[model samples]
Target: MVASPPARFSVPAVTQPRINEANRKSVGPLSMPPRLLLGPGPSNAHPAVLQALSLRQVGHLDPAFLAMMTEVQELLRYAWQTDNRITIPVSGTGSAAMEATIANVIEPGEVMLVGSMGYFGNRLEDMADRYRADVRTIKKPWGEVFSLEELRSALEEHRPKVMALVHAETSTGACQPLEGVGDLCREYNCLLIADTVTSLGGVPLFVDEWGIDLAYSCSQKGLSCPPGASPFTMSDRAFEKLSQRPGKVPNWYLDMSLVGKYWGAERTYHHTAPINMNYAIREALRLIAEEGLENRWQRHQANAELLWEGLEDLGLVLHVQKQYRLPTLTTVRVPAGVDAKAVTSQLLNDYNIEIGNGLGELGGKVWRIGLMGFNSRPENVILLLAALDRVLAAAGYRK
Candidate 1:
């Protein structure tokens, strides 16, 4: 026993290496807990979508991948409810899609009449300006919808070559009525363009019926996919505009005339398409197809009604009027004494939930809640109401 005790070996200290110039930027591994995504975008991806993304990777130009891409284009056509041959997904976020539509449609020095209702409406105006178009805005108060009269007056006054509007204003939860505006644009001989980023899939978006010449949407919002892919659809008229551009589009990455070749029958290469993201988008569209368009719209409408009832029961004021409120996104007035940011932070930290704060003029004055696609469910409505009640109570706001 004494001899055995004397044979023990000492252990050496294991030291981690210090940061060197080459490795200084390297970060440690990250761990993220699954949190409920109820923000303006990036709602939860469907399980099937997640499964699709996990499938084996293939070369970007692989025949199978290209076949899948074609299927995706067709599926997007169904989701967009359009037969436009040039419809395809751009390899970027919603903003890229918006830029692509604008760049393709507007020539330098062309006038673009834009609606200024909230943040995204302002973004359209800015994009028009960047593209060297003379931008004219029909301004409406934040949290308010623009009337047909308002849009008609703007069209009469500006006579812009292109009229741009946000079908669903995420910032103020306002859904602009497309029926009259589209007709007005037709009457004015202006190409109608819309940002449907927050309305697609969750709402009834009829590109052809609305006479929208060009429209774009993100996968993350109503499609229940990740944010890297943006679905863009264009009418033949808009494509003709692209064909007749006096000069090259400002952004090559978004040049539809060239990009169409890759997504077209030619199977040419514009850039490396995001293969995995396409898979996710395909799966997301599949889910929407299974749900059926009318049923999906009704589901969103029903969930939004529940949310409205709950918020009203709690004595909260909805920002947008009943007729104009977006079904997928709701904006509620931030009570006078409550700190909107604090309530949002508590909801995120304590409940593992995310909600959006108001944007632009509505900032610090309203809270924007999204009930989009997969995130629009009865359980989510209840969860949000209960959590918000707790938050408001703690903030000394009476229920």
Candidate 2:
């Protein structure tokens, strides 16, 4: 059929309101300020990872991309020290991965016990509640972690289908000891879910050995990649729970049963994967493999210790006890009569360094400093301390 003379416009096409140019401006090319990210997350992406991010993309299902996908999975298994076959990066942030775990395992009205040790634990409770899980919580002060005995008592009383704990409580800089907590869950015949957002690559995490059934983490923080594309995994037990679930997962985008096919042997397309993010994460995980987990963990620990010592020497108090402190993140008590945000601002505006103020109940009470992945280094630690010393002094903090 011959096309009718090009469709006629209402008035004359040229006279019609030209696509609104009001919102368009001659903006300069994107340029963000140089920032030394020493905050709780989005810690400076490793230079190598950033380089990978700039690499050309491949179709999500292409052989080249699929091969890289497998490599990423293997490296993630190494980083988390788990052999869970369903392990893969979710296509969103840490929060999405966090929700994905809850959405899949806890059928509506099933009890979920959340050990609310800090900010993220509360987040887990919220996500579980939204998923219609019967969310129960046991609380600790912001900077303290739950003892294994406390966890046992909570589990015994709640008898939940799942128990969620933060492996590293970012807001408080407290590392929750998972050694016996997992065993406690197993005793109660409950699946253990762990939030490893701040712990995965920097802290000592043994998912398989620890008896954790489900876990999730971010691309930032310890992984040293940009945010987006979070790591998620489920033990066979957790996957079985998902397989036997009564209905489709409540939230479709994060439902791993469908998402898993794309990452699993089926290679079924669920969504267009974030191609460059996969590249970036591969490079970040590659760095972990090259440096070796032991060496990387040691480097993080050493730098954290250096920072702790330097801060102590400068008369700033660390919020968490040394034994329980996270190598990746630290919470420093705000000095008396000192403005927390001001100190943070001075660090960023004057020194080109960024540190976070606390979140939730800890807000304005502590400063969150991070030594994560590529940003965890002796030089960065020393530079931060020196800058902090000056900033504190300028803020009228006395030694």
Candidate 3:
């Protein structure tokens, strides 16, 4: 019995790794589908951009990384058509860039005027309030754009220190005109902040020419890069205002003064930059440059026209007026009898095609189809139209 007990007590050696050492565990291979990305954003990245992300990992401050950063700045400058030295990629998405611009420009109690024409404008007003600024907004119905006269009136009445406007409202698919708004801001001695998240690379953006003191965008929408990086530019005057902030910027992570030092020639370290995301953005920007800004803009415009023509031919109506429609994002009015959600679901489940539903007030009533960067191709346009036509027809809705 004692011998048997001894034999039973011979325990097996512990072979599993300790819980604290789980970092040594092997990871499974990643698998992703080959579905077409034609949503409001996160359009398929160019092959080159994907390849860039596959490159061997490097330190954030690696000499090669720094060089790439310089090139990125230059490429962003080309995309934004700005000579401002403060142009750089933020460490987060388009929203981060928006927050950075607002945080750096507006201080507590500062008067900020915004156009409440779409979702992004609502976001801007929210951000201004979060920053403790006195927010004033000019309301317009969703899917409508602000006129120059309306903006001028707001500037005159509010006398805000800064005015924020969205160049392309993704929610409503309306492109707000910046024609005289910048000059109006200048006339009123106020800074002009423009949100170009849905406009950059897909449309023409002349920061200096437009008198935009600050502008920001994301790489995924029109640059064809995977999300996670935001390209933002600030003018010399805006930088001057940031330098004079009486108190520290509200968010240390987004403080442009410190971020600029890291991204600037000093190459200082404020945080560990997302190296792979930067590589993705650099390559995306490079592709945009290779395509030529004017050519890329034209491509988007042509694709948009094709989509609109096809959709209208199929008897669908566009939400925004033709004159104010955004090139990258199109808002389609949901037919009276069709369920917007059901149509989108069928398109995804049956056809494997992904599009966007409208946001805010336009939700459930409109469908957003984005013809952006790499997704702005004839083939995609045709496929989307064909799929949409089938789905709507099956649902007893025309077009």
Best by lDDT: 2
RMSD of candidate 2 to true structure, Å: 3.0
Question: Cα lDDT for residue 320, model 2?
Answer: 94
Candidate 2 lDDT over 239-291, as tens digits, reads 99999997999988988889999999989999999999999999999999999
lDDT of candidate 3 over 1-399, digit per residue (tens): 445557668888779756546555655578876768777887888898999988998999899999989999999999998999999999999999999999998999999999888889999999999999999999899989888888888888999999999999999999999977778888999999999999998988899999999999998989999889899999999999999999999999999899999999898999999999999999999889899999999999999999999999998889889998999999998989889999989998888888998788998999999999999999999999999988999999843
- Give the TM-scores of the predictions, in the order they appear: 0.93, 0.95, 0.93
Model 1, residue 169: C-alpha shift (Å):
0.1
The per-residue C-alpha lDDT of model 1 at residue 356 equals 91
What is the clash count for each candidate, in the order shown? 0, 0, 0
Off by over 4 Å in 3: 1-28
Residue-level lDDT of model 1, residues 175-256, one tens digit each, is 9889867778889988998899999999888888788999999999999898999999889988988898878988999999
Clashing pairs in 1: none
Residue 191 displacement in candidate 1 (angstroms): 0.7
The whole-model lDDT of each prediction reads 0.90, 0.92, 0.91
lDDT score at residue 47, model 2, on the 0-100 scale: 88
With candidate 1 superimposed using the best TM-score fit, by how many Å does residue 204's alpha carbon deviate from the native?
Answer: 0.9
